[model samples]
Target: MSALRFAEDWNEADLSAVHAVLVRSYWCEGIPRETLARAMRGSLNFLLHDAESGELAAYARVVSDRATFAYLCDVFVIESRRGEGLGRRLMERVVAHPDLQGLRRFSLVTRDAHGLYAKFGFTPLAAPDRGMEIVRPGLYLQSTSERAGT
Candidate 1:
């Protein structure tokens, strides 16, 4: 395994890689390329690169106000690169990012990654009773359908 390098800088190539991966994701499938670009521009991004192949091995980002709240989203290690601890490395770097530190709260929504997040001290909300959301399931899919009039 070649040593992985982490970077905060990104380029159009990186954005393309991110879109390729995210388009296959359950949460982001059907999301428009421009939407992804816009979101990336608004967030603090962390990318993991394969030193040997120069590939974008993993990525995560936080949309935060840099004061009181941070929402961790768009986290993924490409399928070919999973199960080698890259995800853990990504989360470690994300939580320790200077701009993300000292925030009053950090949150993420994961359908099946509780174990990974838990290793970084994330847990089911202590007050699950206090948490609420107005979820729009299949939002991207709905938009796609509407646009196609299907």
Candidate 2:
């Protein structure tokens, strides 16, 4: 495998590659292409591409005001490329990016990848008052309704 290249910002053309991995990864969830395009326009998105093929292999986006708080969302790595440490490399860049260096807190919710994330100083929010959502009901409902209508 070639060394991974980190892209701190994405262009319109990069969305399809990024979305391809997202749709196939374990976290499989549907995100509208237009919504992803809008998110990519922001500065907080981090995309990792295979340097050799110039194809996106992993992706994660941080929703934040660049200070105080950031939520890591939509993290994924393609199945064919797992076990090669790409996920770790992706997380390293996202958490260490200069703009994200001193946030009050960074959080994400994962269903079964706790071991992978725990290696990066992320722990379960154990406090009674400090937990995260694995899914958004309204959004899920909206998607389901839309699909059913189709």
Candidate 3:
């Protein structure tokens, strides 16, 4: 296995590779590239890649005000590269990012992988009753043309 490198710079992103993984992911299945691109632009992104090959191996994003609130999402390690601790490495970077410090709340939604986040002090909301969201299931079920607003 080749060594992996971590990068927080969006300038080093291989967006096509990231898109391929995300569109196939259970959470973002069929997500439009345009939408993903916009979301990436609006958030702070973390990336991991093969130091030698330069292929994107993992990714995660955080939407934050850098002061009091943040939402972590779209985290994943490529299926072929699982068991290499890449996800944990990415999370370590996310957790230690200077821009994410001192937040009153840092939250994430994960259908699975609770164990991973647990290692980073992420826990269930202390008050689920106080949390609310207008979730639109299947919001990403759109064709390229529609998703791109063409």
Q: Top lDDT: which candidate number?
A: 1
Candidate 3 lowest-lDDT run of ten: 6-15
lDDT, candidates in the order shown: 0.90, 0.75, 0.88
At residue 67, what lDDT does model 3 achieve? 93
9-115, model 2: which lDDT tens digit per residue? 68766788776655544454565676567766763777778888888878788888887888887787776788888889888888888777788888887888899
TM-score of each predicted structure versus truth: 0.91, 0.79, 0.91
Displacement of residue 134 (Cα, Å) in model 1 is: 2.3
User: Which residue segments of model 1 deviate by more than 4 Å?
Assistant: 143-150
Candidate 3, residues 20-61, lDDT tens digits: the string is 888888788878787888889899989999999888889999
Residue-wise C-alpha lDDT for candidate 1, range 61-148, written one tens digit per residue: 8999998999999999988999999999999999988888889889999999999999998888878899888876566766666756
lDDT of 3 at 2: 88
lDDT of 2: 0.75
* Candidates ranked by lDDT: 1, 3, 2
True-vs-predicted CA distance for residue 128, candidate 3, Å: 0.3
TM-score of 3: 0.91
Error of 2 at 114 (Å): 0.7
Query: Against the true structure, what is every candidate's RMSD?
Result: 2.2, 3.5, 2.5
Each prediction's total of clashing residue pairs, residues at least 3 apart in sequence or on different chains, is 0, 0, 0
Clashing pairs in 1: none
